[model samples]
Target: MTQYDVTLEWPDDGTDTVAVSPTETVLEVALREGIRLPYDCREGTCITCVGRVLAAGGDETPGAEEAVDAADAFDYRRQPKALTEDERANGYVLLCIAVPRADCRVAVGPMVRSEVGDSPWS
Candidate 1:
């Protein structure tokens, strides 16, 4: 199986590194590794698991092509209801359903926390 490197950066807890298989969601991998990321409905109906894609590949230049490529790189299996098309274009992803197609750097939003005890999911 192929694996992709995922780096999650949280405001309070700094950063965490994990490897995810193409078949696994970011949240699933994080939880399995004991990394606490905030989430409400694991079903993608909520925005609690939202994170920003700080970087994906070398396509940081903002343009239609970059946006399309970013969308193609991150697999949000279901329609991410919590995010607008503009938000999606801007690199926001719902971690509960996001499966990276390549190595990705995610900026954990303010709503997220890292420590196991600090997690609302716990």
Candidate 2:
């Protein structure tokens, strides 16, 4: 299995780099690495895990030109419902379902407790 490098900017203003398999979601890798990323409804229904792709590639090259647009970079196997068309167009992605095709830098948002119910572990 091929793995891609993933750089995640957490809600608390910390950054972490980890390896993510193509078949796994970004949130999964973060959690496994002990990186606390905001997430709710691991199935992609909730918007709590929304993040923006700052950059994406096999190597770390800084600049907008080197970055992959989150709108186009996200795997289409599962379309997240929390984000609107405009939000997606603006680069918002649900980390719970996003599978990166290349190394990626993502800016995670604050955790929003689910209105439906509180997570027992949270």
Candidate 3:
């Protein structure tokens, strides 16, 4: 199994340093760590787990799929603002669907939580 180092940032001053496996989804790890990042479908179809790649200072390894271009980002399961090709190339991984191929540093931005309206379920 490939061991990857990952860093996650949350709005509530929460952070995590975890060892990730090549087969483990980012969403799985984040949930295990109790991060408040939003998630819907655990598949790539949802963009709720999408986030920015803060740093990728390692080997250029082939990711799960070709880097998603801004246009393709929209065609996914859940519609989200398209991320620039550069962003996707530089290691932006959609947490729900992305599994690490190398050690990575990623930051989930604050806007995701801001958009969550008062939940009728809650």
Query: CA lDDT of 105 in candidate 2?
Result: 77
Q: Write the per-residue lDDT of candidate 3 for residues 9-79, one digit (tens) a residue.
A: 66565667677676676677777877666777565544556665544545334343444232321123342
Q: What lDDT is obtained when candidate 1 is compared to the true structure?
A: 0.74
lDDT by residue (tens digit), candidate 2, 1-122: 88877787765778898888889888888898888888768876767777777765643455555434675556744867666666666666778898878777777755422212322233
lDDT by residue (1-122, candidate 1, tens digit) is 99888889877768898899889999999999999988888876767788877677654443334433337458877877766677777677889999889887777866432211122233
Give each model a TM-score. Answer: 0.78, 0.75, 0.59
* Candidate 1 colliding pairs, count: 0
RMSD of each: 6.5, 5.6, 8.1
Q: In candidate 3, residue 15 scores what lDDT? A: 65
lDDT (0-100) at residue 15 of candidate 2? 81
TM-score, predicted candidate 3 vs. hidden true structure: 0.59
lDDT for model 3, please. 0.54
- Candidate 2 has its poorest 10 consecutive residues by lDDT at 112-121
Where does model 3 exceed 4 Å of error? 11-13, 58-87, 112-122
Error of 2 at 46 (Å): 1.4
